[model samples]
Target: MGAVVLIATLDTKGPEVAYLRDRLASLGVDTFVIDSGILGEPVDITPDISHGELARRGGMTLDELQHAGTRGRAVEIMRTLVTDLVREKFALGEVVGGISVGGVGSVMGAAAIQVLPVGVPKIVVAPTASGHHEFAPYVGTKDVMVVHSIVDILGLNPISTTVFDNVAAAMLGMLRAGHPLGPPSADTRYVATTMLGNTTHAVEAMKARLAELGYETVVFHSNGVGGPAMEELAAAGQFVGVIDYTTNEITDPLTGGIHNGGPNRLRVVGELGLPQVVVPGCIDFSVFAAGQIPSALAGRPVYDHNPEYALVRTPEDEMRQIGRIFADRLNSATGPVRVVVPTRGLSIPSTPDGPFWNPAADAAFLEEVRANIRPDIPVETIDLHINDPELGRHVAELFSTILDSTRPKEALA
Candidate 1:
């Protein structure tokens, strides 16, 4: 079995790192340590990979990094170097898991582990994980686990010892049981799809229908992270096609909503030229946490999604803008694509007699999309609600048609 890699800045964290190394050794796990310190000499132990060698691999001497004019610049250079080193080690099958043991270590170690493929067990133990720090840098779009060390990682003590012990044990468990990273097998036909609480029933039905069509569905929630993570997997060739059923992430960037999936949300699968069915599901509103609603939207209809989130209805103008954005992105698709719309409602709250019902606003989006999208792509509109099982079945049939059209005749046989 390969060893678990431990990362830390040895200058300031030598004693703590040394303690963690011994703890893992007692658990029958081999350890490979990397020192990212740039200034002082390592105190308690020698690392398998030293900072000096790390600097050399990055095309500079340790002294050159130390004199890089600013601490941030030096850290950036070391971070990139460590990331490349870890990637190479994983590629060579030398890494079973990874652990990073301090605040700064968490940041640098996360960059390294993010370069590793999915399903690799990566952990970050830091006091910062307990507080109100933004975790995007630590987890990014990967599955890295973050453990909050109850006390600061200054030195060995009873509390710190217990934490390090558990970290080692957890790594061992994952290394023994976790699935290895790789793409799906040739015979496994998987389809990627997205959904939200508002459209759960529809997606469930869609999944069943896709299963009946001899394809398995990997459904992603349309939360801020889920959409991008699905796209990342799609780019890795993990799916045959996509049913983008909940696309409110597109309205998020313009409305400052909390569910924003960044600018690349709808671009990846299209760029890959995968057959896709795009729906404007949940596009009638922008989401915000309670008490965080902006004053500009004071007069708009607000639906209380829960105690934590409020959904504000999008107006006609914003819907038109979203429509154009969707059309422009879809126009760049190099493969089979279709646009499906539910004229009765885009979400539960936008149904007739619902709080967010506004046919004029919805119609504005349809007009803009039809006007701006390419003439070859077909746009289908139905009179059912977005969550209707029939709507999901219809989408499944549409995706099947496109997939059949794109497959080679030999594969179809």
Candidate 2:
């Protein structure tokens, strides 16, 4: 195992971090400390890479970084250098699992750890870890583990010590557990699937078919975080093909919904040149958690998905916009691809006479997709709902054909 890199602002989190280093040292695990702080008086514990060094590495000096206007920039610079430094060290087998303690003003440390590779046993202990909305961004698509300190990390008390001890043990546990530290292995090829609650039947059906065809299926919920993670894995060459069944995540960004999967959702799969079967699953509604629906949409009809979640119908205009975005993305694909629409419905609730049904809006989206997509990119419409068994079967068959066509084979024997 490479050394456990202790990350923190030695100027502020120095005492607690030193205590942690000493504790892990007692346990016979090698440790290295990196100080990302910009300004502070020196502490008794010297860091392997002091804050001063980090500032210089970030193209700033100590005095310059102390200014109010430059502190945020300095932090960002440090994040860049630190990420590169840690990644380099990891390639050389100098760093492995890591731990950091944060309270307030600890954004830099958290940012640094976030850059570490997934499955590296990285952990961040912060008071905000429990309910902070920022948690999702901090660990986007990465498997970085966060532990809620439940108490401020300002001083080492009973709670802090117990928390630190647990973190140390956890990090060591993961390191010794022989976790992956670099590029993923390609022992088995997998298919990536993006699904939503409304598109569950389709995904389940496709998954079963894909398994029978000897390909692994990795399903992602097309919610806020799932879409990003699935896409990130796809970009990393984690899948042989993508089943783009849930186009709902893109609607969030277009309509200001909380589940905005960012602007790069469908674009990643297309750019990868991976074979895919795209469907307009759940694109008819924009989902939001309880109490988060925008004021402008207050008058619009919504489906009370549950006490904690809801969805608002997408108007015809918005459907057309989503279609253009979808087609623009698919047009960039270098691999085999096809767009299929379930004419009867996009979701269970959006069926012909269902509460969310609106053929005018659906037809608008479909027409836009056909108009904007490349002439060579086929667009097919079936007289079935998205969740219908017939539609699922068609999608599965199409994906199977694409997967086989995309598979690399020997030219001649």
Candidate 3:
């Protein structure tokens, strides 16, 4: 069995790290401890991978880092070094699981473990994990388990010991019974797709049709994180094509909606030269929390998705801007790409007779897209609602045609 890796800032968290290491040892588990502390000497224990070695890996020394001016810069250096170390160890099969204790340790440890594949066990024990801090930085697109320490990790105490003991036990259990990720199947061709509540029926229908066409479908919620996560997996060579059924994340960055997918949202699969079918699914609106709509958009049509979320319709000008953004991103595609638009509506609330019914705004998007998009890329329009099953099946067939044409002759067999 491989050893479990423990990470901590040894100057402050040494005792807790030692206690957890000892507990794991008592349970017959081997461990390698990494000290990420920068300023002071390690307290109460020695680390297998000292902060000096970590800094040298980044072409710097402890003296240099101690005077790095800002704590943020020092932490950034250590984060990069530790992340590389953990990734190397995991690649070499030297570590089976990883745990980090305390606040700074949690951030560095989570960054390190994020490089590991999905099945590896990674845990972060920190007071910040207790529902108070935003978890996106720690959890980001990975299967990291964050446990609240309950008490500050200054030293071993009743509460701290219980948390460490439970964490050790949980790590051991995961190591013993967790399923290891194996190589992808040679016979299966996987396709990645995105979806939202507004485009559920369309995505489901596409998934079913893709399955019938002998392709496995991996569906990702097109919320802020899910789209990027899907892109990450796609860049990892996990899928042959993408059915981007819901692209609302594209509008979030423009409107300051909560589902912002950042700048690289729609560019990954295209950059990888994978055949992709794009849709303007859910582009008719931007979502905001209740009572949080921007003052500029307050008077526009709003649909209360729930008490927590309000969907504000995208005005014509914004839609036109979104269309230009879409065209720009899609124009750079390195492989076969197709854009499909649902003329009747882009979301349930935007359908005819619905609260956000605005054909002119939808038309504005289509018009801008056609005007600016690369002339080589085909733009197909369907006179159907975005959720219509027939539209989904049609896109699936369209994707199949593109995939078949682009696939190597050997792959076609």
Candidate 4:
């Protein structure tokens, strides 16, 4: 196996990158450097074909990106380019491991490496190592490791040099140990799907169809980590397509539901520009633990779906906010996006004569979408209930259509 491709904007990180390259060489490992600098002297390793090429492969190119200067451009360029490059390299068995270093740029660029097949020795040493990793969800259950370089990423000082050397050693050891590459040769196209208990039937149905169609289905519980994790894979170009079947987590987050998926929930797919089909699967209510329900909702109807999970019906006011957030996110997607709404009900309890049925709140959210999301984004509202087999199939077909449209024409050849 070859070296773990050490990726970084070599222009600004000349000293640090060179130090890492030398260390890896000394350790008897081959290293390939990718120059993502927009404007600078020629780099040692092949540069990304072009900045526009990076944007076309994912989003924003290095040259067209709005950054501060050469350093900033290199950072952005490397972040996006390295992710795509590493992804491709790992796919082709050209790399056994990957390492990256930077502050925000390093973290962003390295996130792609982290998403590589589990146990391929992924390590990222970042300058900004404090706080909740907004990118952790994408890393998922992968064995990706992070080392904090307490000092800022400037020239290679004693501190920064030590950090990089240690990180390089860790990655080298991991690769040498030779962890098992996951199950033999199953080209399972990963399909990222979202689910909550209320929307289990639809998600399962979608999963069944995807499996029948020869795809590996990864069902995210949508219990805070699920949605974000699924989105992370999408951003890393890990997902062949996505079925955003249940978006209630956004409402859960907005209404102080114990299961909030955070603000960057919809951002991953939008940034990665993937074919997406969204539904208000469980939008009618927010989930919470029985004890965490607010006093204001004391008299409001509360139902225990299970001992561990409880549901609180959303009020008209909160639904408006949910609508605003959803619309704002959907409007920003650059890919072929479609939002599907089930008019009959969004969840099990929201069905006709069901415990959580409330048309006013659902209507309010739908109205917001109609008014705010652009016409080009494609909004489809169905008359059937969310779990209805007909509605399920309709959604599945819609997602299939969008996915097919997004496929590269060359694949057909």
What residue pairs clash in candidate 1, if any at all?
A: none
- TM-scores for the candidates: 0.92, 0.93, 0.94, 0.59
- Of the two candidates 2 and 3, the one with more favorable lDDT, higher being better, is 3
Residue 397 lDDT, candidate 4, scale 0-100: 71
Lowest summed-lDDT stretch of 10 residues in model 2?
404-413
lDDT (CA) per prediction: 0.89, 0.80, 0.89, 0.72
Q: Can you give the lDDT of residue 380 in candidate 3?
A: 95
lDDT per residue (tens digit) for residues 1-413 in model 4: 76577666555665677788789889888776654444554334343343345555656544555353666555555565657777787778787777766666566556667657766787777766654455563244466687878887777788988887888788778877868355423456777888877777777777777666666777888777678777865765667778888887787766677678888887668657777888878877778766778776776667788887788888788888888888888777778888888898888888768888889888998998888888888788888888776766677777777777777899646
Candidate 3's C-alpha runs over 4 A off are 408-413
1 or 2, greater by TM-score: 2
lDDT of 3 by residue, 352-385 (tens): 7899999999999999999999999999999999
Tens digits of per-residue lDDT for model 1, 1-413: 78888888888888898988888898888988998877898888899999999999988899998998899888889989998899899889898888887876679987787876688899888889875787777887888989998888887889988998888888888877886568889988999999999999999999999999999999998988888988999988899889999998999899899889899888888889999999999989999989999997899999999999999999999999999998998888888899999999898998778998999999999999999999999999999999998999899999999999988899888
Per-model RMSD to reference? 2.2, 2.2, 2.0, 9.5
Select the stronger candidate by TM-score from 1 and 3.
3
* Deviation (Å) of 309 in candidate 2: 1.1
Rank by TM-score, highest first: 3, 2, 1, 4
Alpha carbon lDDT of residue 361, candidate 4?
Answer: 84
